[model samples]
Target: MERILEPELMDDEQHALAYAQADFVEVNRGFVDRFRTTFPDLTRSRVVDLGCGPADVPVRLARLLPALGVTAVDASAAMVRLAREAVQRAGLGASIRLVRARLPALPFASSTFDAVIANSLLHHLAEPGVFWHEVQRLGRPRAGVLVMDLCRPASPSHARDLVETYAGGESPLLKRDFYNSLRAAFTPAEVARQLARQLPQLTCRVVSDRHWVVSGRLP
Candidate 1:
């Protein structure tokens, strides 16, 4: 927690991010597709979505898997508020509950969830070890945790340039926001190395384009 980015600040960024990525249907679908393909046995499991900005994942999951219950959590209060609003608007108020809480110190009990997922949340953390241990604690003994993060750039400068170019004339604030996200990204190998050392029981893999997925039944 001490080493992690302040969720309070990042949460505000997340609210803005929902609009920035509002049309990112491909990115959102990519994750949903991958998770289903990766875990076909999962019919309607209880799911926990970490760093669930604007409540997108939970809302989507509940739509895709009507039988499942999804709990979305984020460190940002504003983001959680947005998430709750979104869930309620979707008429899925009973299916998803958005909570304002930081990762690596989850409020739920052990074996509380059938599966846990994190999207673009790992790199913002300064102490990923705490993240692994805490998420492990919340997971069912043989349940899964799906993780997605930006692949560290081959060249930081190139990445920055790409972000600036994609960030068409928003504002200095918006431009800085995109740049910070790229800077905070972690490479697939780097993520694997870190998880291997901390969450030895989990398996980490890279998906198409810009995402990395880490998951396995906890030992």
Candidate 2:
């Protein structure tokens, strides 16, 4: 299936609210766990999460690694607000900093982060190469990087099946968004090619029926 582009940012209030309220406990936890397992020697103190929707992963990472400082960035104001509330509720205001910024042009200086992580963010971009470049520009040499996102299915029917199988109980808005995301997602092969041109050190693999992950350290 050809990739269908969705809106780059979930800036709409209702869309953001529905996405923030949706149950992603297992998925988010798995993402954090995967990062920890992939980079067990992650001794760096500075970490940044791009497209940190609701900040659940950031909060979880902070709780798991109390010494590390997390900077979570999202383009959507509503998502940033929701993330702030989540961080405050988790009593991790000091450990996690929430920033509202668009991608491919973040405010941070080059090589500012020890690690760069993003979840479910790649498919939103029309020019993913630029996003990869930004990730490369932000991370210091040998910095850990883990990016996970939906994998485009073989057909639209498969996409709908995935939505039904995984997000059947979610709200209508959430379900619709999931479908659109699946449609917008990149295949593992395509992601691998992108990494080859922009982040050759990274490894792209299909981690699940609907997800692919690119993980490794910067050169």
Candidate 3:
């Protein structure tokens, strides 16, 4: 299926609130677990999470690796606000720093981060190559990288089926957003090609029925 672009940022108040309230416990936990397993030596690295909606992954990672520092960034003001609240509530305010910034133009210096991670962020970009380039630019040589996002279905019917299968109990707003995101997601082959051109050292693979992941260390 051809990709249909969704809004780049979930900036709408109602939409952001609904998204922040949605249940993503299982998937978020899986992402953190996989990251830890992929980079076992990264016990005390400085990590950056791009498109860190609500900051759940950062909180989870920080909890798992108390010695690590996490910098979570989101372009949407609403997401940033919600993420800050979550960090404060977790009492991890000192371990996780929240930044309001967009991809392809983050404020950090090149080779500053020990690790670069993102969840469900790539599909939101209109120019995904630029995002990959930014990831390469930000991480130091041999820095660990892991990015996970929805894998575009073979057809629209498959997309709806996924929505019902995973988000059947979600609010209408959340359901609609999920459907849109599924439509907007990229295929593993496409992501591999993007990485080949912009980040040849990374690897891409399908990790689930509806998800694909790109993981490896910077060269």
Candidate 4:
């Protein structure tokens, strides 16, 4: 199936509020655990989180590693506002720095970070290569990269079933966004093809029932 493009930024106040109020602890905690396991002994590392919505994962990660410095970047103004509030609440104001920058065009220097991670941000891109290219451009040599996103279901029925099963507790508006995001997501095959054609150095794999994790060391 062809990919559908969704809004790139959750700048809308209602959308941002829904995202901030929504419970994503399970997913965010899992991401932090996965990152810890994957990059063991990464103390005092400088990491960049692209498309960090409300500073969820980045805040969790900062708590996990107090020495770690995180540059959490998002394109949405509302998200940035909420993220600042979250970081302040988490008392990680010193560790996690929030930046309002769009993907594929970060304001940082090339090859500047020790690691780069993006969670569930791929499907929002109409041109996925721009993100992949930025990963290489911003990551220093041997920098770890982890890009995870939802996998598009084989059929629309499956997508709906997923929404009902996983997001049944969410409000109707949030569920609607989830369903649309599923439709916009790329399948594992499509992601693999993009990896082959655009970022051969990185590896892509299905990490969960509904997620694909693309990760490797920058070449």
For model 1, the stretches where C-alpha displacement exceeds 4 angstroms are 1-8, 13-21, 164-172
Instruction: Report the lDDT tens digits of candidate 1 across residue range 51-138.
Output: 8877777777788888888888888767777777788789998888777887666789888988888777777787777777777887
- Full-model lDDT, candidate 4: 0.89
Task: Tell me how far candidate 3 lies from the true structure as C-alpha RMSD in angstroms.
Answer: 0.6
In the order shown, the candidates' Cα RMSDs to the true structure are: 3.4, 0.8, 0.6, 1.0
lDDT of 4 by residue, 11-83 (tens): 9999889878888888889888888888885768999999998999999999998999999999999999999
Regions of candidate 3 where Cα sits further than 4 Å from its true position? none
Point out the worst 10-residue segment of candidate 2 by lDDT: 36-45
Judge candidate 2 at residue 21 and give its lDDT. 88
Candidate 1 residue 75 Cα shift, in angstroms, is 1.6
Task: Output the worst ten-in-a-row residue range by lDDT, candidate 4.
Answer: 1-10
Q: RMSD (Cα, Å) of candidate 2?
A: 0.8
Q: Record all residue pairs in model 2 with backbone atoms less than 3 Å apart, i.e. clashing.
A: none
Residue 5 shift from truth in candidate 4, angstroms? 1.4
User: Which candidate order results from sorting by lDDT in descending order?
Assistant: 3, 2, 4, 1
Any idea what lDDT model 2 has? 0.92
The TM-score obtained by model 4 is: 0.97
TM-score against truth, every candidate: 0.86, 0.98, 0.99, 0.97
lDDT of each: 0.73, 0.92, 0.94, 0.89
lDDT of 2 by residue, 1-219 (tens): 999999999989899999988888898889999878988888556999999988989999999888889999999999999999999999999999999999887999999988999999999999998889989999999999999999999999999999999999999999999999999999999999998898899999887898888999999
